[model samples]
Target: MSSATVDTPEGGFEFIVHDDHHHDDGEHHHETGTMLGFWIYLMSDCLIFGILFAIYAVVGQNYAAGPAPVDLFELDKIAWATAWLLLSSITYGFSVIKMHENNKNMMMFWLLVTGIFGAAFLYLSVEEFMHLWHIGAGPGASAFLSAFWFLVGTHGVHVACGALWLVVLLVQVQIHGLTHENKRRILCLSLFWHFLDLIWIGVFSFVYLTGVLL
Candidate 1:
C-alpha cells in the first residue's frame, strides 16, 4: 500500500491517506503555511503603496501653474465610484459566508454580483481618467498630475487585476464545484479583495478627499 500526505482543509495539520482508502494521523500545516506566505506578500504590497503615497505627498502640490486636483476632480463622480467599490466588498463578504455554508450556488451568485460592482467601479474610474485627459489635465501636465495619476492609476490597475481574477475564479468554481482547492483559492482571493478595499479607503481619504478639501 502507498500513502501520501495531504493537508486537511479546516485546520493546521496534515494527514496521511493511503491508496486503499485507509487514513492515518496527520495535520493541516500546508494551508497555514500558504496563508502566512500570502500575508508576507501583502506586506510587500503595503511597502509599495507606502512609497507611492510618500511620493505623492512630496509632489502633489507642484502643479506647474496647471490644473489642480480641485479643478480636475469631480467629487460626485468619485463618490459614486467609491460607493460601487464598497458595495462590491460587501458582496464579496456575502460570497465568503456562502462558501462557509457550503452553498455553492449562492456563493457563485454573490461572487458574480461582486464582479459587476467591481466592473462598475472600473468604468467610472476610466471615464474620469478619459475626461481628465480630454481636458488637458493629464499626468504629463505637471508634477502634481504625475503623482496623482501614478498613485491612483496603480490602484486602478490592481482593481482590474482583481476583477479579472474574480472572473477566472467564477469559471473555475462553475467547472469544478467547491472542491477543497477551489475553496482555498476563494479564501485567498477574499483576503485580496478586502485588502484592495482597505487600500482604496486610504486612497479616497488621502488622495481624493484631501485633494478636494485641502
Candidate 2:
C-alpha cells in the first residue's frame, strides 16, 4: 500500500497510513471494551451492597434485647476509621497522578502510603469488631448484630482484598516498569479503590450515622 506524505504547519512531514489508523482504532475499541466490562462488574457489586443495605435497613432495629447501635457504636473510633479510608483514597489518587507522569518511584511511594492507610482502617475495623464481640455484641447475638456484621464485614473483606491487590500491583510495577498492561491494571485498581471509598461513605452515613441518630 502506498502511504501519503503530508506537510505539517510546524514544518514536519507526516506519513499517513490506512493500516496504522485501523490498528489504532482497534486498540481504542479494545480499551473501551475492557473499561465497559469493568463497569458492569462494578454495577453487579453495587447491587450486592444495595441488597445488603436493604436487609440491614429492615433488621437493623431488631435488637432482640441486645445492645443497639447507640449502645455499642463509638462515633470517635468510626470517624477515625473513616478518615483513614478517605485519606487512602486520596493517596491512591496521587499514585495515579504519579503513574501518569511516569515517575515510578513516586507512584510506588504513594501506593505504599495508600496501603498504610488501608491497613490502619482495617485494623480499626477489626478492633471495633473485637470490642463488640467482647461486650456481648457478636454477630450471633441478635438480628441487628448479624446484619451489622454481614454488611460491615463484607466491606472489610473487600478492603482486605484491595490491599492485597495493591501489593501485587506494587510488585508488578517493580517488575514491569509501568508498561501499558501495568498502567491498565493500575487504572482498574484506581477505579476499585475509589468505588470502595464511595461505598464506605454510604456505609458510614446510612449505617453508622443514621443508626446513632435513630
Candidate 3:
C-alpha cells in the first residue's frame, strides 16, 4: 500500500491506495543510499591500501642483512595462492549472475564455492608465513620483512573477514529467501569481493613479482 497527500477545497487529506506491491519513496531512497554509502566505504578502503603500498615501496628493499624476497618468497606457493584468489573472484561473479536470475540455490552454491577458494588462498598464505617464520625471516627480521608482512597480512585479514561474511550471508539467504534487503546486501558484498581481487592483483604484481624479479 502507498499513501499520498492531496489538497482540495476541503484543505488537505491523505489517502491509502491498495496495491500488489509497495514502492514507497522512503524505501527507494534508502536502497539508493545504501549503495552510495558502500561506495564511499570502498573509497576509504582504497586509501588504506594505497598508503600500505606506499609504505612497502619505500621500505621493501631495506633488507638489513636479512633474508630478501628471493630467499624467503616461494613463487610456486604464491602462484598457487594467486590462482585460488582469482578463481574465487570468478566464482563470486557467477554467484552474482545467479542472484540476478533469481536462482537462490545456484547462487548459494556458487557463493559456497567462492568461500572454499578463499579459504584455500588463506591456507597457502598461512603456510608460507609459517615457513618464513620457521626460517627466521619473520616480520621482525628487517624493514623489508616488516613492510611485506604488514601489507600482505592486512589483505589476508580482509579475506578472512570476507569469507566469514559470506557464510553469514548464506545463512541469511537461506532463512529470508531473496528479499530486497538481502539482494542489496549481496550487491554490496560483490563489490567488496571484487575489490579485494583487484587489490590482490596489485600485491601479486608489485609486492611479490617485483620483489622477486626486480
Candidate 4:
C-alpha cells in the first residue's frame, strides 16, 4: 500500500501521514521524544531573552542626552544583516537534512556554508555596535542607548555563541559522523538557531522598524 503525502510550502515536499485510526502488527512504537528536549531548551532561552527584553522596555527610550535608534541605525545595514542570518537558517536546514542522509561530505559542505553566513551575521552585528560606539552612543550615553545595547547586544551574543558552537559541531560531526548523541545535539542546535531567527524578527520589527517609525 502507498503512503499518504502532505503539501509543503517549500515546493511540493513529501511527508508520511500517521494512521491515527488503526494500530496493528507487532510494531514496537517508540515514544522517543526529541521535541521535548528542544522545547526545554527553547523555554530556557526564552527566560534569558525575556529578561533582556524587559530591561530594554524599561530603559529603551531614555534618549535624554544621546542619539536614538532613529539617529544611528541604517535600513540598508539591517537589511543585509537580516539576509545573512536568514540565509544561514536555510543552509543549516540543508546540513541537518544531509546528516540524516548520512552524506557526510554534503553535510559538511552545507555546515560550512551555514558557518560562513553565521559569521557574516555576527560581523554585521559588531559593525552596527561599533558604528554606534563611534558616534558616542555607548551604555553611558543615555538610557535609550543602554537599553538598545542590552537588547540588540544580548541577541548578538547569542548568535556569536551559536556560530562558535556550529564550528565545533562541524569538527565533531566530521570526526564522528552523526552518532545518536551528536544527532540529538545537532537537532537541538537547529532549534536554537531557528529560534534565534524568530527572535531576530522580533528585534527587527520592534527594535528597528517600530523604533524608527514611532
lDDT of 4 by residue, 80-195 (tens): 99999999999999988987887878988988998899899888899888888887888788887777888888899999988888888888887877754466567778888989
lDDT of 1 by residue, 51-84 (tens): 9999999999898999888888888988998899
Q: Which residue segments of model 2 deviate by more than 4 Å?
A: 1-30
Q: How far is each candidate from the true structure, as Cα RMSD in Å?
A: 4.9, 8.2, 7.6, 9.7
In model 3, residue pairs whose N, Cα or C atoms come closer than 3 Å (at least 3 residues apart or on different chains), thus clashing, are none
lDDT of 2 at 144: 89
Find the candidate with the highest lDDT and give its number. Answer: 2
What lDDT tens digits, residue by residue, belong to model 3 across residues 1-214?
2333322212112212311133454233435556788989989999999999999999999999988888777888889999999999999999989988899999999999999999999999888888888989888999999999999999999999999999999998998887666777888998999999999999999998899876
What TM-score would you give candidate 3 relative to the actual structure? Answer: 0.86
Instruction: Put down candidate 2 lDDT per residue, 84-183, tens digits, no spaces.
Output: 9999999999999998888999999999999999999999999999999898899999998999999999999999999999999999889868765577
Off by over 4 Å in 1: 1-30
* lDDT (Cα atoms) of all candidates against the true structure: 0.85, 0.86, 0.85, 0.78
lDDT, model 2, position 177: 85
Give the winner by lDDT: 1 or 2: 2
